[model samples]
Target: MNNYPFGSQAPKSFPAYPKTEFDLESGTAIKRTRKPKNSPFHPLRMIKSFGNRFHHFFKLHPLMGLFLALCFVLALAMILSLYGTQYGVQSGGYVKSDMGFDDYPFSKLQNLVMVAGHSIYTSSSCGKIEKEDSWFLESYQKNPGQAATFVTHIHEGIEIVARDDSALLLFSGGETRRDAGPRSEAQSYWAVADSKGWFGKEESVKWRALTEEHARDSFENLLFSVCRFRELTGTYPQNITFVMENRVGALEKLASDQGEKLTDVM
Candidate 1:
């Protein structure tokens, strides 16, 4: 018999049974699980676990740690750039200025013997252009151009010099190459002009061509060519012309010497 109200919610009661455990296919009681003392639910334990992971990462790759440190420093630099100290016109900048046209004594010369120094060949032009043909490199390396870019200026110089009656066209370069034999750069230009037909008045222009050997540089080319010009004409050049990319300064230096006169043309 139950001791509970019939019409109300009744209190639960355990069924009468033996004190010994019953077997469901020889079953037994199992222990229940408890919460870990250092679980993620504990804030300090979670912090410690994260710190350990970071430490393990650094220990695995020292280089990776260094890379992270460098990134941090670079980020700092980028942030600092906002202060205008990193970039501005007045803050560590570069600008270029041009050398404008100014009159030079060589600017008025008639017997213009344009001596373009080794800057055109044996140096700038030769080393830069690798085209193994008539380029300054191949020509100077194998056989020197009758005049090289020097001839280009020489032709220009001759045009100016031809304005007068007495003008000599001279090109100078030594046997810089072993295979080219004993021919100087001057002789090569003479041959090319003679062979190529010197533009109508071939014989007349060919008579004006001269050669100067032993000039290894621009100064030597100018000075030696001047001496050769004086020797040929039996008088110093009344008006010496220098045709160059930029000839004023160089011509100034040469013309300022004792008994030398020159005029510069761009």
Candidate 2:
């Protein structure tokens, strides 16, 4: 009774699905969800709600609203000022230091030990400066073994700085020798110290060792170095020390002029 034979082709009938019926979820969900009160998705609504509350408060007590706004502004200003102070450019130099203690070693080190330089090293030769002819000596300092004393002073200063972790060593003098072609005594001492390898404390004390090159006399050595210390460290020293006698009572008089006391090394 079939139109086609069993071994031949055959066709069957079925209901075709509509496109909307196939896409049922998009057309209509099983359960609809209502947005919660104070929904985060509605920012403009939240701002409008805040404005309404503020308006109500302002209408009730205008003085209170003014006071509250003033307080908020003050607090915001305080916060900005604090951040600005913490993050602003300091000193405004071409080479400005960061607002951290790590880069400022001299500030952390509180004590100063000054070595008064006596002569300029006038050597055209290199390195063996423990002898007499290497220095630009005065007539009085023309004797043998006199140049070695300068090296000794540098060594002693380095040793002291090495022993005290909080001390900075300074070689202080100026270019008093006009005939020596602008070489300063402070520079000479530093060069000698460098040649000596900072007396074996190169790693520990060499970096702390520096020179004050504008001191033309023993008094200037003290005065200029103190100013130099303040310039570099941003604070005055708690104490100062150097090895020299009151040869002409100038140091004693300088101390008296400032209303301070000096303990005589003699």
Whole-model lDDT per candidate: 0.55, 0.77
Candidate 2 residue spans exceeding 4 A from truth: 1-105, 245-248, 256-266
**Model 2 Cα shift for residue 97 (angstroms):** 12
The ten-residue window of minimal lDDT in model 2 covers 93-102
- What's each prediction's TM-score? 0.44, 0.58
Q: What is candidate 2's lDDT per residue for 1-266, written digit by digit as tens? A: 75776553656545465433344567542444667788357889989999999999999999999999999999999999876665655357334334454455578887777888888998876476877888888899898888777777777788778888987788889999999988898888888888788889999998888889999888898888777776667666666777553453677677667654333321
Per-prediction count of colliding residue pairs? 7, 0
Superposed by TM-score, candidate 1 places the C-alpha of residue 176 at a distance from the truth, in angstroms, of 2.8
What digit string (tens of lDDT, one per residue) describes model 1 on residues 98-165?
22223322322336465443322232223232223532344334544433454465456556545565
Q: What are the per-model C-alpha RMSD values against the true structure?
A: 21.4, 15.3
Off by over 4 Å in 1: 1-112, 115-132, 135-151, 244-251
Give the number of colliding residue pairs in candidate 1: 7
Cα lDDT for residue 178, model 2? 95
